[model samples]
Target: MAVDPDKAVLQELARRNPGEPFVMLNLLRFAADGRASYEEYSRRAAAFLRQYGGELLYAGDGNEALVAEEGQAWDAVLLVRYPSREAFSRMVTDPGYREISRLRSRALAEAVLQPTTPWTRRAG
Candidate 1:
């Protein structure tokens, strides 16, 4: 399970310009008594998000899964939308944001951070 994205992932993200906003889907598994830590991180991250033109779309604790594998249910889920990939990249690389991320790292047992690009169906 990856808690953070690596340089390779960053590089790949950098190469893509979908010409649309990017929203990250966070699937989280908390460590023992880790919600508090994640809350701290989220509190700290709120400022950075505003500074970088990003917003927390939704954040909620997960519950029953209507469909999925037995172990596939997440402890929490978050949707964060960024103005652009460059803005997101900048935020991730920011020294201040990195410090805030420490709390998030400590709070999570595992996480899947997937960036979603909005797209509309093309009809002919």
Candidate 2:
């Protein structure tokens, strides 16, 4: 249940982007009574996210999964799209955002933050 990204992860994310838009998929496992704190975090984090060309595509409590393994169910799901990986990295690394990140840390027992790229047909 790693909530924070390390230097290595940031480095890899930085290396991979060519300025293309990317979406982040977040799967959250909240601790007891963690939802309120997470909501607060989200409310405050929205400004910082927007400053870096990021948008909250969706954020909602997770419902029954049509398919999943045991222990794979998440409490909430969040989808955010960023103009680029650099923008996202900068947003996370910003001092203002860092200050408010504690709320997110306190709210989740486990979480998944994955970057997704849109698919396109390849030319033959």
TM-score of each: 0.93, 0.94
Model 2 reaches what TM-score against the true structure?
0.94
lDDT by residue (tens digit), candidate 1, 1-124: 6798998898778679834578999999999999999999998999999998999999998999999998999999999999888888888899999988999999999999999977888997
C-alpha RMSD between model 1 and the true structure: 1.4
Q: Model 1: residues >4 Å from true position, as ranges?
A: none
Q: What is every candidate's alpha-carbon RMSD to the true fold?
A: 1.4, 1.3
Question: Per-residue lDDT for 1-124 in model 2, tens only?
Answer: 7977787898789778648789999999998999999999999999998899999999898998889998988999999999998888888899999999999999999999999998999999
lDDT of 1: 0.90
Cα lDDT computed for each candidate against the true fold? 0.90, 0.91
Q: Any residue pairs clashing in model 2, and if so which?
A: none
